[model samples]
Target: MPADFHRIASGRPAAGSTSFEAQVLPYLDAAYNLARWLARDDADAQDVVQEAMLRAFRYFDSFRGGDARVWLLAIVRNTFYSLRMKVPPDGMQETFDDDAHAVVDEQPTPEARMLIALDVGALQKALENLPHPLRETIVLRELEECSYKEIASITGQKIGTVMSRLARARERLRAELTRHSTEVRRHDVQ
Candidate 1:
């Protein structure tokens, strides 16, 4: 067996006494991915991930047996929202149409169709375009596949609020994805 596992599984220091990289580094990518998806920008995402990792390390002794993913996600979510609220708003908030979200929900799109034809790059860009609340909800619920309760706990919102944000996020994402698909097709044909 590898030396690192022997140390961690044996409840001893791994390799050195300085830090538990064996126990923590494995989850680093997951932390960064969740943060990036939530922040929707590389620079901000990296910042969140670094800060979260430091926080995690600081409180590592308190973590008992449970889902580390959720624990880490909660940290990322908190960090992202704290930073999000500090940014000055532009006028685009009016573009988020709650009625449009409701309409989209009443008529669900086929996932199979999206999976077959959707452009991955376009999907990434579309996600980046969404408002912070909508984007964060979608990232946690859909991309991260978090439960509604988990999302609520992370965001400190009611379950109903989590559901609503997720719905609106989906609607905006769908519209953006559809528009991107059309643009890509047009570009391809030209």
Candidate 2:
């Protein structure tokens, strides 16, 4: 948890409502995970989480007492998009794909599955290489283990869109990792 988390928890909600500590603190790491992957930097991730925490505090009263994790995450997602508008773009540059609608969900090769299971570094690099939408979807669904409905809530997209993104993300990751695994094997044969 950030140092700000302790101070932020001081904001007491009304009687019968959950405290900030009880609500958002538990998911701080989750928020950081989402932000870190999205921002693609430790420093920027911290900044994004901090701003998100603050926004959650400001609107803490508005929380209707259901799924604080999802609610806080929605705020974090919004905060990231908001920051993108204010600041210049950073190193993570994935062009928008116009043909995402046409991407067929494909099964991974066995080698791709093995790579994903065994090669954490390669998997991480391939995941980072994905487009932001795909990356975020994978991170949210795989890393955070959010339900499609929760993902839709946090991302403000329909469940179908979330499913589509997750499928696309997985397929792209499979291709990248499979290609990498093949290259590594070729090198070993020499």
Q: Among these predicted structures, which one has the highest TM-score?
A: 2
Over all chains combined, what TM-score does candidate 2 have?
0.79
Per-residue lDDT of candidate 2, residues 1-190 (tens digit): 4455555556553431247767777999999999988987777788999899888977877889899999988899899989988887854344323233122335878757554544766777788799888998899999999999999999999999999999999999999989988888887744
User: Cα miss at 118, model 1 (Å)?
Assistant: 8.0
lDDT (0-100) at residue 174 of candidate 2? 94
Give model 1's TM-score versus the native structure.
0.63
- Residue 180, candidate 1: Cα error in Å is 3.3
Runs off by more than 4 Å, candidate 1: 1-25, 83-118, 183-190
What's the true lDDT of residue 133 in model 2? 87
Model 1 C-alpha lDDT versus the unseen true structure: 0.67
Q: What is the lDDT of residue 44 in candidate 2?
A: 77
The residue-level lDDT of candidate 2 at 83 comes to: 91
